[model samples]
Target: MFLRTPPLTAALLSLALLYSASAATHAKENAIASAKESIASSEKDSTASSAKKSIASDSYTYANLHDVRVSHVYLDLTVDFANNALTGFADLTLDWQQQDADTILLDTRDLTIKQVYARRVDGQWRKVSFELAERHAVLGSKLTIKPGFQTQTLRIHYQSQPQASGLQWLTKEQTASKNQPFMFSQNQAIHARSWIPIQDSPAVRLTYSARIQTDKDVLAVMSAPTEPGTARTGDYRFTMPHAIPPYLLAIAVGDLEFKAMSAQTGVYAEPYILEAAAKEFASTQQMIDVTEPLYGDYRWGRYDLLILPPSFPFGGMENPVLSFITPTVIAGDGSLVNLIAHELAHSWSGNLVTNATWQDLWLNEGFTSYVENRIMEQVFGVDRAIMEQALSVQDLKQELQSIDADDSRLFLDLKGRDPDDAFSGVPYTKGQLFLMFLEKRFGREVFDPFVKKYFDDHSFKSITTAEFERYLAANLLDQHPGKVSSEEVNEWIHGRGLPASSPNPQSDAFLRVQQHSNAWLSGLSTLSELPTTAWTVHEWLFFLNNLPLNITPTQLQQLDQAFNLTHSSNSEIAHAWYLLALKTGYRQVLPALEQYLISIGRRKLILPLYRQLASTPEGLAFARKVYQQARPGYHPLAQGSVDEMLKAD
Candidate 1:
């Protein structure tokens, strides 16, 4: 993972030694237990606002939280599957840092407020006056409540609207086990307001506990640890000792079962998919073991993965304990399991040390991406990690060309814009390259320690870009002035385009594949002559992606005949093949491509297909036809992307 900077090799070796020594003495069990206790005691100022002032963000939340903080939250909810809504009460424990603070505001969307009450040391719930601010089209309404000065607890009884953006209610037809309905929540980038009333900002972190009552036939799971012996009682109690931003508060209810991969790691899916999920992610526990030395510890009690039905929006969400994953990655060949590494890395980068605001999202994603590659290199192989890195760079370059210059920068200005606009590959890829840049310049020996220290210091806290920059300056630059400078770092973080010092990712296997692709396109090699056996999915993707644009239908047919790519089971390879097929007018893949579109809801794979398919009138017709049928099976987030792409056409 290091370049030929003169001192880097020594630095890398020394870093490994340092990590080994420190990890040997690290008390992981104690740390996790202490964190849980701290969460139970509500001793953290986890809800402190970001270093940036509230005005710095374009969020609709009206409260100035500098004087008051919510320390912990309790959710008592009942799932009404018939009505597709949540009838619940949220009890927020507040710490009034300022004696003069009498009123507080929380964000809400499409929610009907039933009652508001407050209690103090006297322990009596008294009625509290509250007002709902005029709602914005996208930002939702703000619930302003007068809880009186120094009020310790504020409780609101409310019911979420059926159309709450965060909650997705699916019919039995949408699930793998067609006999049961499914429900899950996606609350990132401010959607939490749509389901639960809270200070919905990444800056505001708080410990939470939940009591969810669901149908007896369904299993209830949340971001917290599952309460014992409640599986059959229809009453589930869970607690999370670690404080997290509201967006990370997740819940799902379904006919689900768990299968353990190791003592502390496992998988959850429907009865039919459980075994495959368990096998597909068997490397997860090892990923955790590999990652602990790189960072300090896995503070989260247990790490499990929940494989959502096809329509789950993202590849993986780094939910504490349970990482919600898309079923598409269970390719049966295990080539896609690196996604598990990416999410597990978030246990440290995102779940432990979070970005204070969406503008600084790179802090969460970029670091996670880098750590993911490192873990993949250790647990999978170096070549596998290199292949993924090259793919990431390809994506980053394409994204840079397509997006606005300002939007391509590592530090983003998402003010007055939907934060989702900034959730592209830039943060994940460009951010990783930025860290790679530093590692190359300063050497891994010096850089690795800084990363471990960064997480150690910022664990359970949200940080801003400015804070990170200052920290880097104090830790890395001040100690080794000649290695890297603040001005050079700024060019990577704030300036547009890849910096001159950006890491050039090179994979030997990818290089050979590219050469073969060039030779085939140049008429120097025949398809039958190429060394086709022993190729992994990454090699196939490199070959397909590097194929000549505007390929002739004959060439596409030759490839299809030789590789059977149009019917490939691997989603990664199939996606690449389908895109080339569409471009080359290889009509044979039309049905398979359409079926692929219908079967998978991963935005990374489908949106690009839909966008490319919409280019021609006939293609647009087919895309629209498929979308009309597929829309019901997609999560709102995925549907929203496709809807806009089709709408524009």
Candidate 2:
């Protein structure tokens, strides 16, 4: 799923402004397209050469992949809960790209390297000399080892620091099962360097195997598929047969119990949340059943979910085979299962075919989001899917207003910046919009096959935006002449904002909800008279989102009184209501909001609330006070983001 940020304050105006582009805008687009086409025509050969070079260049990592590449990683690690660290050695099998190269460089962050050993072609392991380079604020330190010529493997013994960015160690009190501690890894976007010493670039794909030792009382899981009837002993083994990017490497240790949702799908959570999570996500098999016939077969053997504690930073991290999900999504009614669909779609778009660099993140996210909506439409009704799309578009428009034009492009230039900071609604939503444009122009009959073939052709590979464009042109656009021009595609990818021809998702359900919202805000009807009992989560979000920006405190109170929103069991509805309460200065909701912030640690839900609270002096003090108490429970990523946000305020 895309990183969730707060919606812009002037969402209604932003939506109007996005859709109502003036004639001059069209003229400018044509001019820009013509110029871009000319430049592309001139630089076609150089551009191809540059594209090949860029495919291997990743700004995020210090690994020199051109010299030596990592083929497979074998981790023999022990979970040390007392020290809040993982102490072990990683045996990395190397593929010598340059025969003359004798040195291998790997990425590391806040790790203490004790020793290094190299395995020669004769199968003898000998101690090797290594150096830890100066630390980089973002890229971490580079561990360089001179294993000598003809060495095919290296074993690096290291220990992770307590404050490693990727791994979060939670105290027993921070877990649902208060009797045991929990630890999980969130390694996307370069955080993997903090825990494991490897080529931490998405451009390099490698298979991995692990033997993780944890407390005998707790269960341990990895991104790899687990064998049926595996022993529950402290020593656990896993193997990921297919090669994947390092960021997809994941591990979790907790007092987890599993319940089968289907023959291949299951839920793993603490005893407290296992049943609820399983019930809420009972449709996992249906999602896979529907997605496989459209896309290719499910390449990864089994698809299971691990419901992490509330402190899991993202809504869901699409770790292969086993996805790390936040507990906040178990809303009892399964209203938020779209998040599941989004993550499952990543099985194809992201895990099977990945983005070569963070700059082309749209290749992973945009494709997944488009496929997610398709899955939603297939499983849930079209009305629900359209409502979700409309909400996404609304959020994107608001996000575009604040995001810089350069960052707004589907092809981002995040050379000197952190990819995490560069995230926004642009890649996920705008990329989806680009595909929707193509789908609309060339009907699904033509587009569906293309999507299926695209996934099949690029399975188990990392690709760049240029590579995808070339494939699209050859397979889809060129095959069906006069359907879409290269210029239009260029605009969607390289242009600052949405193109004039962008598809606008409209929902009849949201329209009716807006009508009721307008009626109540205009004083034509009382809140108690509105028909909300039958409303779904999507309808509630639309209703609350379209409420007038200047809604008074009394108006908020009336809505809360009638709907009991402040006390709603649904996390989505409660978050929307809390945002409104903060905006309207309704102090009655403060206690609930504070409790909500403390209990839930999903960045998407909590970041916006904290930002809203920091909008005023009194609220800022309250936010700080609450954050001090809530800080221990938050994951390192959440803690860092919230700290930066509050510090900036």
Candidate 3:
């Protein structure tokens, strides 16, 4: 079974405290190295030939592949969403026969497998033995039988309607077509098997073509480059020229409407959501404008977005051609559509340069997250881009808090495909943070071109962290010579937590948590109260934002009158004190609650204050209007305190 972040307040506090200490030191040391590199590079630039030779001596560039290319794959997927079950069949053709007879595992959970077949050297296919006892379906077979690395077709039948795959999700859609009932997939975690069976591991990728059959009225969607032609009897077939890993192979079907901007791309959504979907699609041009330059032109033909029901997990899955996004972002407002650009950038980071295992998942996530930052920068602005990275840094700290393991890579095995192990720190947040570190190392003058080349060379092939390091050193590392030691960077690729990685003294945030610590706090709350679980940085920010928006000025004054600071509210409050502070400005009252904010280590939330102080005339006017109309209400906090809160800032 998989374990999640610990359910302890201490662990949560520990994560934030320790993570920042390491990150800050790491950053400070990096800034120094970067400055030296800039000065050195500038001095050596005019000696072109010598500079080029010296650049060749550097060590941080990611390496190029000598072998290991996913030649082609064929996918036959069958699913019954209403029943939440799936069966899949696939055929793979590799360039060289694998000598190790490795066990290829598919990301799956709680599934019953009836059969499996693989083509053998005996000129016939046999029912190969497999294990389904754990979360993954594991298969071990030799390819020597196929000698020169011939074609191998595999057939696997499984059944399960998964809720947590992060890749495949089943939910009802409210769209225009009565015929198209919308449902989606979100296989970010290792849950691809709950819907389709293949080498569900990202380590083994294959060119995928999905044959999906949904309810007749419903339309089926996949990441493949092409669309399903007419319903063709009862089933529809969609194929792609790109090699796709199982996780990125998505399927979305629902009551859908199809509108085309041109022959190259089409939009899919509920009939009623057509206009809403359009707003998301409107940025298509902007996405192209940014991603093309970063990864060297749009290699994928066209991009489309499929909006799933509101309850879909995660923001979206980066399905190559057609991305499956949560309708939660389909709000008439455009703020949420940046997710589309994020997934779109994955066409390069995830789809093109794939990670070999979940161990190096940062190869997929970190790169994608970074590239998503690029897309946002170009499409939105530098402020939005920096803001997004800031969110990630915050999330990493929270995840560190949630994780019970001091070792972040415990779940990752030597080859990076250990499904049954627990997660280590280097996998997600830390991994991505490393990429940002790499950017600071390379700097813009040298980094941009290197990144562009990196994508261009490795697109459509699998890349490991080690391989990436080789490329970095051979290219950029030589340029920065004294930067990271090859040994140090290589150690990072295969190491546990950093040598300097350590926990910090417990933070005041927990001490400042006055919501449930009062002498009278015990009885007023429900038996089952839900504190916002700060799983990701966004959730943590939401928890912070939750404080201000829900509190009011009047309630603040009242709270001052009968102070429990910890006074708990049993009522299902629509808003909380902190949330109201966020909107109305808690400047004056912040001095009163100064100890709590400092204890929580959120003394950095001055962004809200800066916004208030720097607001343009028009913006200030809007803020004042919102402030004047703010209503007075109580949640456990007092009404008078709420009034003071609005006037404080």
Candidate 3, number of clashes: 85
Q: Encode model 2's per-residue lDDT on 59-158: one tens digit a residue.
A: 8888888787776677879999999999998877666666678888899999999999876544456899999999998888999888777566677899
Taking all chains together, each candidate's TM-score versus the true structure is: 0.91, 0.91, 0.59
Candidate 1 per-residue lDDT over residues 1-649, each given as its tens digit: 1111222223223322332233323253233223333332353333332232442343535545666667567787999999999998887767555667788888898998899987644455678889988888667898999876667677799999878888889888889889789999988888898888898888777767676888888899988765222455577766665668888999999888888888788888888899999988999888988888878878777888888888888899998888999988989989999899999999899988998888999999999999999999999888899899998899789878988889988889876787878798889999999998888888889889999999999887888898899999999999998888888989989999898889989999988888887888889999987787978888888888878777777888888888888899888889988888888777899888878888888899998899898899889999999998889888888888888889852
RMSD of each: 8.9, 14.1, 19.6
Q: Candidate 1: how large is its RMSD?
A: 8.9
- Summarize candidate 3's per-residue lDDT along 1-649 as a digit string, tens digits: 0111112222223322332233435344234223222322333221111112111111111111112222344455565766655555454433333344334434345556666655444435466666654332222211212122332344455555444243333334323243444456656545454555433556545444445655665666677654424342335565554445666767776666666644555677777776667765687667776676666877677777776654343456778878876554554546555677778878788787877665456677667767777787888777556555555555456455655443454224533333423333356456655666666666767778888898878766666666777788898788788765776565555555533432121223332333533221444653134243322222333334334444555645544344333222210011133334435654444432332222111111221332443354543444344433322111101122223433434
